[model samples]
Target chain A: MTVQDSLLAPDLPFPIFQISQTVRRYLLYDINTVTWLRRTHNILGVFIGSLPQSPQQNVFFGLPMELQPEEATLLVEKGLAFIADDFRTHKQAVRSPPRAMANYKATARKEALATAKAVTKQKQLKTQEVLQRLNVRQGTPDADNTVDNDEPDESIFDTSTQETSSRPVSSSVIPYSSTPTTSYPPIPTPSKQSSLPLPEVSASSYALFKHLHALGYFMSPGLRFGCQFSVYPGDPLRFHSHFLAMGHDWDEEIDILDLIGGGRLGTGVKKGWLIGGAVKNSDDNEKHVATSEDGQSEIGRKPGDFHVRTFCVEWSGM
Target chain B: MGDLQPSALTAYIEASRPVGVLPQDSHHHALAAQVLHNLQYQHDWTDLRIHTDSSHSARPLLKPLVSGLPPHRIYVHPDEQIEMLKQSVQEKDVPSEREWVLPTHLRETWSLRKFAELFDGIDPVPPAENQASEEKPPFPTAKGGIGSRRGGKRLMLATVGDDSTVVYYVVHDGIVKPRQN
Candidate 1:
């Protein structure tokens, strides 16, 4: 699946909003965009939203998928998404015209009033049915006559009548719309001054991420697994991660103990410990030049910028 | 085997055992002390002290916390960074503040509520000096002085693996602005 086949409009790149800069939180709140990214691109960013049903429990989560920096960078590079500064867009959205706000309020009020009326009618019908049933149980020959009789049980009818009468005719009960209101203008393209470039990731780590991503593996932040990335063969929902991947500079010294610890940990969890880096080559100088030229102007790196080499380690249990 | 001696860490842990706590709680005290030991010797931290009670109410803390001044500032709040950038002040020039360190075992599972409770028990910033420990010399105040506008409450989470490897992460009380790379 490609960008053209996305559920979202073909022309619009999925917007990955930078929710926070200090802790580097990139979030996607739009359900459609999240679904498209998951189904089409196999990008299963972690859902960090609190589940409404069980707000206290952390076993399950809801919405606002949090993407790792590598995932965000990859999506931007592939032209599948763009980073937007959420604070700026939100400020712009709140400044919508008063006319639009009034129009939305009117529509919302109308809908609420209709719902209130329907609920009252339904309640009245239920009361009538119950009254008729009570009369039948009392062996009344004419249930309808019993209901119409003024001497019949007035308590139930009185309460029902009072409830219907007390029901608010206006839609003041609803303080806000349950659905997202269309009154706010669409998020505008951020001005250059406020625009956010793609999230920055280490060159070697990004290279490793790009390499693994191209192989159709789904990856997530590996803080829990004590590695740079935990890679799964399919959606995390359906499969366990198969590897704990760490990225290092090509010429950087490898600590033997770190390799052993990673391997042992991975083996304990039935996964491979993988290490990799971008191999330095003559094209590296050109890449540096390209990076310098694009500095602060480009949102993502060009494809095929780095040649990555990877090794997977599994403990022999000797 | 007969000539073997107890290591300094073991001896220190024995000597510093917290009083009037459950036997299991001693394990946590040991963990905090171990982290403190690592920070002082391995990491060259100064004015290290183990906190058994809340700084605010004097109630016993959920777990012992270690307070120390690191050789360098472990975190720079995004807003603080922006302020420094505007003032053209280099980050290194900023005085390092004493930090709260929550020590945990690598095997333990943590939740947001637990973290929030921990944050509530502590102050926004650790006390400037270790007032509880008298033997240790007071940390010398930096020449420029610590900034007045200290950011929100934060702590350094130190997870100690079985192999004696301690990994530290800076955790703030709530969502903070992201720092530039």
Candidate 2:
């Protein structure tokens, strides 16, 4: 059923707005689409028999003409796309569950709890056995000739301590496996580091900070306190070279602009395929140079002349 | 609810682990925070906060607001749409650019009551002060404008995972006139 169909349906148990509002709530905030699908069967006008395997390329609601089921699936797809595209365009990337993440926590929690209980029981049984062995009386010291209990006592202590230490360590290892493996890796060594050009402003530039702040845009205090930049000295621009690996071509300069502040001008920091604003030398009297090689500026001004700043920043990840 | 806990977001950041903006200064956070970092670094957005609590849960979605100037034309009233349509009847050169919304990652569910609550706390327009640095030249009027002017719309660039799968949205407090798509 298409969203339109559902709106037109006679069998709707709830008010259309109630259902629509519920659907909107799920679309706007639901993290798990599959769970949303299963729980809110009536959210879409038509129900999807099963989720399409390829979500990225799959089209929903392509044509309006179809049976109720097909139309409903398409409508659901449209709703999903509407939400997804809206989110993508606005950059409000909400966390949706990947197929793997779906219901993983619930099952994982169950397994973890089960394993923990079993481990506790196992440990308790082992400790009890040890105690039983230790407390076992060999013929109760009455009738038969008694061997020195101290001799066996020393061996028992050594064996029990060894068993106790080994059991705990092994038990701890089980819990580690129960935790989900992290996706992010730790920081690499310093030698593997490639330097990114830091933006540096002179002590005099501190005055600009106040003006910017008063204007309702603030630099991160960390950036203000410690931001560094590459100085070009007398020349307004500097050229640095690095060898390209694999697909990168030589002489490719990409500029990334600061679109939110600094007059919304491009910063002089561009990586490969990553374009930004070029820092305009306010002092450069030479006919204002355009940012691009072809001299085309998106904003119709020389990119270099758009914003006046002291330094430029650029970096490459690979 | 948001007003009751104005400092909630700040406290969340304080308590959570710090993930550096640059890739090199690696740090650990929950899967959600890492996604939030991608939105911030790539989009140059601010106020990328997420609420992790499970109360009033809706679906698993991230709610974050972008802090910057209005990207393209943010708000289009329904009346304005008609006006633009009439104006375009004569002008042929004007090409409409859909607003570029920044991505944000929110990690909790929200109910209608909560959504209404969030809308209540937010302004009809985006907060001006926390706006991202723009690459475009400031309009002459903006140059002289002083203290806390309209920065633009609230753009939230939210990331769903470790790899960059971002969704952007422009949220409004109440109904506004719709623009011609």
Instruction: Report the number of the highest-lDDT candidate.
Output: 1
For residues A34-74, write the lDDT of model 1, one tens digit per residue. Answer: 77777768788888988567768785676778988898998
Q: TM-score each candidate.
A: 0.54, 0.22
Cα-based lDDT for every prediction: 0.69, 0.31
Cα deviation of A290, candidate 2, in Å:
55
lDDT of 2 by residue, A1-318 (tens): 678545444321111110122223112222133223323331222222223465564444221111122212223333332211222322221243344444565667667867876776676577657655654665365434245543554465557444554465443434324754432122111121221111222322332232222222212222221221111111212232110001111112211122112111112221111111223233431322333222234363333223311111112010
lDDT, candidate 2, at A210: 23
Residues B1-181, candidate 2, lDDT per residue (tens digit)?
3556635433544556544442212222333454455445664444444432222344322233333332134333334445446655322222211222323223423222333334334443332333343323333323322211232222232334334354443332221111223
Candidate 2 DockQ vs. native: 0.01
